[model samples]
Target: MSDDRPLDPVQLDAYFALIEVSSLLRHTVEQQLKESGGLSYVQFQLLATLGDAPSGRRRMTDLADGVVYSRSGLTYQVGLLEQAGLVTRAPSQEDERSVVVTITDAGRAVLATVFPGHIAVLRELLLDPLSDDDVEALASVLDRVRAHMRSIPPRSAAPRRRAPTR
Candidate 1:
């Protein structure tokens, strides 16, 4: 059952702080990615994920899960990347029903171009201010929270419902 009570003051402060920090960090990262590589944050994430994969490729559903994005949204972003010649999609060899997305050499180049700025922004805005202990504590907290959240079924893992016929 859900708790009917409100968050304590400290919890309220932490929640607001997390939200604001997340927004600020994303905004800065988005600007850097767009300026450096002509990519949106999600596009950069897609490329980076594919680039990091052992085979430089991933199934579309896996991509959606890895990036915490909706499948439809991932498809549109992949389409844009395909049009830009940064990525390609093909039917998975292992599963004909699944589409696989792969990063092109050009996509790797874009990642290389943007990664430095991305790291710099992350360092300046997120990490530089934190002491080593603070960083470690934050990491531990986030890891536990992430694991807890992931215990729930992700959107990609859920079966899609069919529309009703008229």
Candidate 2:
């Protein structure tokens, strides 16, 4: 069913601006993560999420939900982190079918090393352009949007990863 309500010109402008800015921000962060720690942006996101968790661990599905990645893609990134000795994965005690991933001390060290630069980049690229009021409004608006998005059933965050290039 389609709604017959008219679209506002202001909403169209905001929608396009949001899309363009988000794309640019993601690209910039991907480049920064690659240069800083030889990490893909999604890898850094996984590490950061695990690092910030109270238990320093999360189930595979939970990690998949928390980050912009698919379950299989998250599994792949977890494997990379495991191979790098930055994290560990084991069968969950509560649910044998679910895997639990935990950030290691090495993961924390990597975050400590990289977080400062991450903040600097965020400030320079996003925050510096906004006034205090603008920042507050942006945060409030985005938080509302995020809540709306989360209320919907989730789909794959993006296309599944392709085979690596030689």
- For model 1, the stretches where C-alpha displacement exceeds 4 angstroms are 154-157, 162-166
Candidate with maximal lDDT:
1
TM-scores, each model vs. reference? 0.94, 0.88
Scored against the true structure, residue 53 in model 2 reaches a CA lDDT of: 93
Summarize candidate 1's per-residue lDDT along 85-139 as a digit string, tens digits.
9999999999999999999999999999999999999999999999999999999
What are the Cα lDDT values of the candidates? 0.95, 0.89
- Which pairs of residues collide in model 1? none
Pull out the clashing pairs in model 2. none
Task: Name the lDDT value of residue 31 in candidate 1.
Answer: 98
Best by the TM-score measure: 1
